[model samples]
Target chain A: MIRFDDVHKSFGPKKVLRGMTLEVPKGESMVIIGGSGTGKSVALKCVLGLIRPDSGTITVEGGEGRDRDAFLARFGMLFQGGALFDSLPVWQNVAFRLLRGSLKRPRDEAKAIAVEKLRRVGLKPDVADLFPAELSGGMQKRVGLARAICADPEIIFFDEPTTGLDPIMAGVINELIREIVTEMGATAMTITHDMTSVRAIADRVAMLHDGVIQWTGPVGQMDTSGDPYLDQFIHGRAEGPIEAVR
Target chain B: MTGVLTGILGGIGATVLGLLAMIGRVTIFLGQTLSHMVRPPFYPREFGSALLTIGWLSLPVVGLTAIFTGGALALQIYAGGSRFDAEAVVPQIVAIGMVRELGPVLVGLMIAARVTSSIAAEIATMKVTEQIDALVTLSTHPMKYLTVPRVLAALITVPVLVGVGDVIGILGGYQVATGQLGFNPAAYLKNTIDFLEPLDVISSLVKGAVFGVIAALMGCYSGMNSGRGAQGVGRATKSAVEAAAVMILAANFLLTGVFFSL
Candidate 1:
């Protein structure tokens, strides 16, 4: 389980996260939904220790201050734009963790595992030799997915996973995320504004607003949650509490 | 008068604060990078790549610049010496100028233009794309994976490059003087060989190493602290080249003062 307790983060005069508190139970898929620039990404980054909170404690699996390297090894993340290493071939990117540090494996074995993961993510074994620039957007996303799951981490983070894909490709990625999360039984936390992605991948939904959780419940109860901000956001209305101009 | 005074004070204060902040940040970054250098999980592959990029590939530019500058210096020195009936001093002056100053300074500036900008742009793009963050997530330190190897390679290789530059520069002068100016090749070579001292060569190599460190350090520092987007990468690259050039020149002056004054 991962928990954020009264997390507050600010950059200069701009307050990004103001006392945000949330919880992700073990083996659950929690999708955070919010309008643009509402600190959804900041919240996720805070948990990952990519961004430190000003005056809050984030406890991961009952430890507030675990060893960073060890803690990071347990989690895998898919960035918004894939974030593949442009200099490396696809297979090298996937097998990066396996090729170095305490988790080092034989080069051949690591390459074989990378190929397997690539296949699992709907890419051909031959695609492993190509650089990230050679692949299409959908293929690059799949490659990013393969790299993320290559380590078989206990926790997975998907940041704007289906943001730039076509609807069909988005659906395919959604299905892939669902299948992977279910099969791996990893605690998945995804942040997306796409309703289709939410419906396909989320067990529970949390709406972030004004640097706090405005509404949170099981996916089925989101429509009838009786919160105006939630209703305005889900229905994609330009009016109500959230000013469209800002 | 009061308003003008306030404005001047505000500008001066802001500049001082900015300088201090930048100094503090660079110092901290240097400490972190040096600390990572002594720790485990060194990447030999990355180090080898850096050595090739900073050392071997830089030879062509360094050679071209040194040769042309040396030839031009010989012509200028010969012309100037004729005014005082000291035309025979061309070989000695050309050799000392190439070995003691021009060779190292020109090579350092070339490195700032080429290697420093390239390093900054590459790392800044990686940062913009979140590859640096991804490296952290993969249990790799960016300083170790990126900065240390490049810095170490620069420290190891730039002195050798300076030595090569010095020799090529002297040979260029020799070619110009013997072939064009009707000078005896053997006598010119002997004059150049006799004029150059061990101290001059040692100072040149030391300057080369210092310039290399400054260039690589500025590149890495600008890159790791880049802002965001394409504009950020461009700014980082520009700032890195500027800083490296300035620092190299400043270091050269200081090193010269220290070495020659003694």
Candidate 2:
């Protein structure tokens, strides 16, 4: 449902995305894998218009020409860090979209939805009133996830959904994401380098290197892709086509 | 020696260019903030909170600064005027000075030190944490939600604070004059009231409004453009206060010239 066409983005002398082109089919979880600083985040940001691509077009079901608010209404994002509004309590963060603007609902209704979403993300209802700072890292990520899915968006973007969590918590998050995407039938785009998370959450896998998608196929095909960069990355080998250091 | 001179000239040129570029960016930010302010989806809740933080919470500091400065100004005027046997002129001078200059300027500077720094640091931290991007992804405009409310609150409230400061400052002068300087309380109050023209009060309020806008805008601009991490936040806060203080003083001078010249 989302398409990136010849996206090229540069920051001064550093060219982050050079001709990155990818398509995410509707109702499928597409996980983008890349090493550090390979512009994975930038690519997702381009789709959201958070970072304008220097020369390219990103269209979400031909919604690029729509009103900015309308265009953004179709999607939700969970940042690398939870990115929860620290000033707000957990429930407020989840209900943020519902409490303001075009999607506004009554305060009670919004709070109910927030509680339900929090529950769906494996959080207790009692955690709703607590502030984000009171939550642990894994709990914070769950809260972030709850916020992302609270609006029932048509598409969801997860940026490193399991970065700082323990292995079991990461697995839990990956499973939750997988179940949510399947149950909601939402198009999902997640960017991460975690092989475990990829195996758990992705229907399709795309390996990014040197600002371009070097290999892409079904998650089952990832192991035998034979592309040096993908093989090196998935294997976590220090010696390969992908350099250990910049 | 020749190379060093060329290097110095290059450095000076770069500094001027940087300053001009900064001014240009801030001007653009101000325009965007104004445009957002006039648009729909007004955030009254955020504005109300901002009014409390910027206006109500600021009263104590503004009052303290004004009262102390007024008393100090009275002492200095008494000392200086005594040289020419003009100690009796303290009430008139203090009233004029507090109403026209010190009230607005000192309050503005205090806000720069307190409110401006806090705003910059908070927004910068939000930026670093990616909450700003989250706001965008939620179909909310950061300028409308964050900048406009604070700026509008400052615009509405700082003038009122300046008026309060002017009165408290005059009262402080009266206290010092009547109690310690051995002037009659009624006469001191009368001279102070008579010396302040309506125009002087208006000028003071106008200066307050301008200084408020400067303080709030500088804080928001530095914050929204801050780099990454704790150091970026610290730098943004420092620069915001510096810019606001300098701008308030400079605007004070220009405003004083404008009001008096007319």
Candidate 3:
């Protein structure tokens, strides 16, 4: 389980996360939905230790931050952009952690593992030999997904997993994400504004606004959540309390 | 007034402390990188690319610069020596000078300009684009995976660049002596070869190794510490080149003193 308790983080005078608290349990898929710049990504980064909060305790399984490497080992992350190494082939990128030691076997063995992971994400074995630049947006995301699960991390964090793809490709990626979460029995925390992805992949959904979680419940109840902010968000209405840019 | 002065002093002290802390972190990271290199998970592709950079790709420019410099040195030595009725010593002096000093220094600067800038720009761009963060997410440490290979490659290959530079420099002097200065080609060749000793070649190669370390370290350190935005990357590349060049020259002087103090 992951828990953030009264987390208060600010960048100078601009408070990004204020008294934020949430918990995600084992084998659960939680998606945090919010408009742009509402600190959704910052929340994920805080969990990953990319940024530290000024005041509050972030604990995993009722334990304080300890054994960072051990903790990090259980976490897999898919960044907003598919940040693959341009110089390496797709196979090396996917099998990176697997080949880190005397477990660093021969090229064939590493490639085989990479191909298996790729196939799991619905990618062809031929794609493993190509560079990331040669792949399309959806294909790269598939490769990114394959790489994230290569180590079979216990907890996975995905940032905007369906932002740039076409509706059809997005649906495919959503299905793949759902299937993988089920296949590995892994807990997932995904942050996206795409309600379609939330509907397809989320077991429970949370809405973040004004630097705090406004509401959270099962995906089936989000439409009738009746909370002003959640209603304003899901219906894409700019009038109620959400301010317009103008 | 006193309180303001104290605050300013405290700020300066904090800045110094920050720099010292950074140095400590870099030292720890360096040790980790060295350890990782000897263990498993070596990337031959990264090493080969760096070798092509710090050694082979840099050769043509180092050669061109050294040859022209050697030719010019021969002419200048001939002109300067004639005043003392010592023009005959040009071949020997040019050979020793090129091997002992200019070859290593020029090649060091060349590698600093070409390799350091390129490395700094590449790494800074990576930092800005979250590629380093991506590596971490992939369960790979950026220092161990990205930095160690390039540094190890530079350490091994730059001495070879220096050795080649030394030879090309000598040939340049030979051309001037045989073609322009009307010296006996065989005699000039004999003087050039016979006047040099083992220590000269060793010192040149040693300088190459030290300069290589300074160049790669400066590049990697500045790049890793680069700030946000494209402007930050531009500054990092500039800083890396300047730091590498200055450090190389400083190292050259120290190595020269140590090598020749006998």
Best by DockQ: 2
Candidate 1, residue B86: the lDDT equals 91
Per-candidate Cα lDDT values, in order, are 0.92, 0.93, 0.85
What would the per-residue lDDT of candidate 2 be over residues B1-262, giving only the tens digit for each residue? 9999999999999999999999999999999999999998998999999999999999999999999999999999999999999999999999999999999999999989988998899899999999999999999999999999999999999999999999999989888888899999988988888878899999999999999999999999999989999999999999999999999999998999999986
- RMSD in angstroms, all models? 1.3, 1.0, 3.9
Model 3 Cα lDDT, one tens digit per residue, A1-246: 888888989999999899888988889999999999899988998887778888887777635355555566677887777877777789988887677642356778878989999999999899998998899999989988888888788899999999889999999999999999999999999999999999999999999888888998999999887899989888888798888686
Which segments of model 1 are wrong by more than 4 Å?
A62-66
Alpha-carbon runs more than 4 Å astray in model 3: A11-14, A61-70, A102-105, B1-45, B197-199, B257-262
Q: For residues B186-224, could you state the per-residue lDDT of candidate 3 as single tens digits?
A: 999898888999999999999998888778877887888
Q: Residues B38-151, candidate 1: write the lDDT tens digits.
A: 998899999999999999999999999999999999899999999999989989999999988999999999999999999999999999999998898888889999999999
lDDT of 1 by residue, A104-205 (tens): 899999999999999998998999999999999999999999988999989999999998899999999999999999999999999999999999999999
Q: Which candidate ranks first by TM-score, i.e. highest?
A: 2
Off by over 4 Å in 2: none
Q: TM-score-based ranking, best first?
A: 2, 1, 3
Task: Give the candidates in order of lDDT, highest first.
Answer: 2, 1, 3
Q: What DockQ does predicted model 1 obtain?
A: 0.80
A33-110, model 2: which lDDT tens digit per residue? 999999999999999989999998887885756488878888989999999999899999999999998999999999
TM-scores for the candidates: 0.98, 0.99, 0.87
Give the TM-score comparing model 2 with the true structure, all chains together. Answer: 0.99
